[model samples]
Target: MMKAADLAAIRAIITRAKRWDLFFSLLGILSLMVGVLTFTVLFVDMAIQGVPRLSVDFFTSFPSRRAEHAGILSAWVGTVLVMLLTALAAVPLGVAAGVYLEEYAPKNWITDIIEINISNLAGIPSIVYGLLALGLFVYYFGFGQSILSAGLTLALLILPVIIVATRESIRAIPQSIHEGSYACGATTWQTVSDHILPYSSAGILTGVIIGMARAIGETAPIITIGALTFIAFLPTAPFAGDPPAGLFDWIFAPFTVMPIQMFNWTSRPEAAFTVNAAAAGFVLVFMTLAMNGLAIYVRYRLRKNIKW
Candidate 1:
């Protein structure tokens, strides 16, 4: 309803705001420069220390006397298995709980309590969760210092991450989809399962993957549950033996993981141990970056493809 003259006046005022654009651009460019430079320095230092130590034994042999000994085969195997198990245990439960709370729960006190606690839990120091795992998995029920204990501790540590990610994804869903499903006479579960979930699945999965990546890097909690620095036997499948090491049997067996092994090496009296430690650090960094990159790529595609 504004007159042409009025519109022209407003446009003139808006054009005046562009005068500060250069300042903002300079600030953004400077910030980016600083970040890149800092990371470049770190990468250079790590590479200089680690690349020379990268050898056949670094990947193939068990830890030995540094220059005389090589490889981290056992620690590598343990870390992968524990991380995989933690992911397997965390993703489904976290997503399901998120979905139920977001889509099905009455907006009541109990639900609010859960929502608040889950957010709060994410901020709790991971080492505290390790203590809880120690009490519950190692002492109270008697699983003891095993890979199972590490996985469970890690699962708890990452659950909050998964839940928070899932909840945000579910919350991001457009309400119109829910209303449309309701209009079509779908049951609450059906609307959530067939429509709402499919719409937000990509986001949920991305969050879970990020959570898993963080869990894979964690050392404090797993250490609290007593991840051994040395385990000679490669882990057999939990239920593959003659007695089929019952869930409790395998879950409580003493085990070693990569981070713990690195910690042990770093504490040793030899310079070779320090070099190997750096190499292991590089390996962890590379693996984490790879997983995070995949998650980001997936998120970009999902955002591009999803309607909302």
Candidate 2:
């Protein structure tokens, strides 16, 4: 019913709007490209500097006073051990707490307070966690400078992250799933175990991977717990037959992780150690990327398989 002139004006306005939308879209793409380019440049630089240092001996030798002789054997082993301990300590507790909060906790002021505090904890600085670990795990609890203490400290740091992820994943499921489980005479625990947990497993795992990835790169909390920067010897193996430090002695032994070692190298006056630092940094980045890739794969598989 519009006049020709009015219709033409309307078309012109829509055309202008579309042009602006296209402009913004291209701007966003350009911004993303900038970030990608920066990362690629840095990665290529590190590869150029560090790839020559990636011999088998580099992975098998211990730290030394000489830059050429120093290696990351102790550092990488300690990193893996600390990560195992952190996972054992954090994952179950985080997942359980998340489940309780999302599925069981009554909606009340206390619950609201708890939820708010959890979210706040996630945003708190990592150094504050280090300070707390220094006070409680290092001094009060007297775990000393052992890997056990470091693991527990890192566990506390990542708990909120895992809980938040679990809750968010569980929340994504339709309420009808819960209703149907209940209609079929499933109890609350049964419903969660059989219906919610299974469906949310992928999300929970992604969160755990992300959390552990963060934990592996943490330096402050481990350092605050009095971890050595120059550890040159491996911890007693969990199951060394000859010396028999027992199955759990390694957990109680002093240790150093890759991040701490890399930090030490980067601080050195020598130029060669800088290359060592770059190599260690490359390893850390590769590990983090692998974990992230696993998370992405998990999410994709779950999304593809699960209808709802």
Model 2's alpha-carbon lDDT is: 0.92
What is the C-alpha lDDT profile of model 2 across 240-263, one tens digit per residue? 757677878888889999999999
Highest-TM-score candidate: 2
User: Considering only N, C-alpha and C atoms within 3 Å, which residue pairs clash in candidate 1?
Assistant: 57-71, 58-71, 146-253
Best lDDT among the predictions, by candidate number: 2
lDDT by candidate, in order shown: 0.82, 0.92
> What value does the lDDT take at residue 101 in candidate 2?
98
Badly placed stretches (over 4 Å) of model 1 are: 1-34, 237-250
Scanning candidate 2 in windows of ten residues, the lowest lDDT window is: 236-245
- Cα lDDT of candidate 1 equals 0.82
Model 1, range 1-308, lDDT digits (tens) per residue?
98999999998888777656877888999999999999888777777887788887778777665445766788888888788779878888898888878877898999989988888988899999999988998989787787777887888888888887887888888889899999999999999889888888888889888988898789999888877776666666667788686654554556777788778878888887777887887888788888899899999998888776
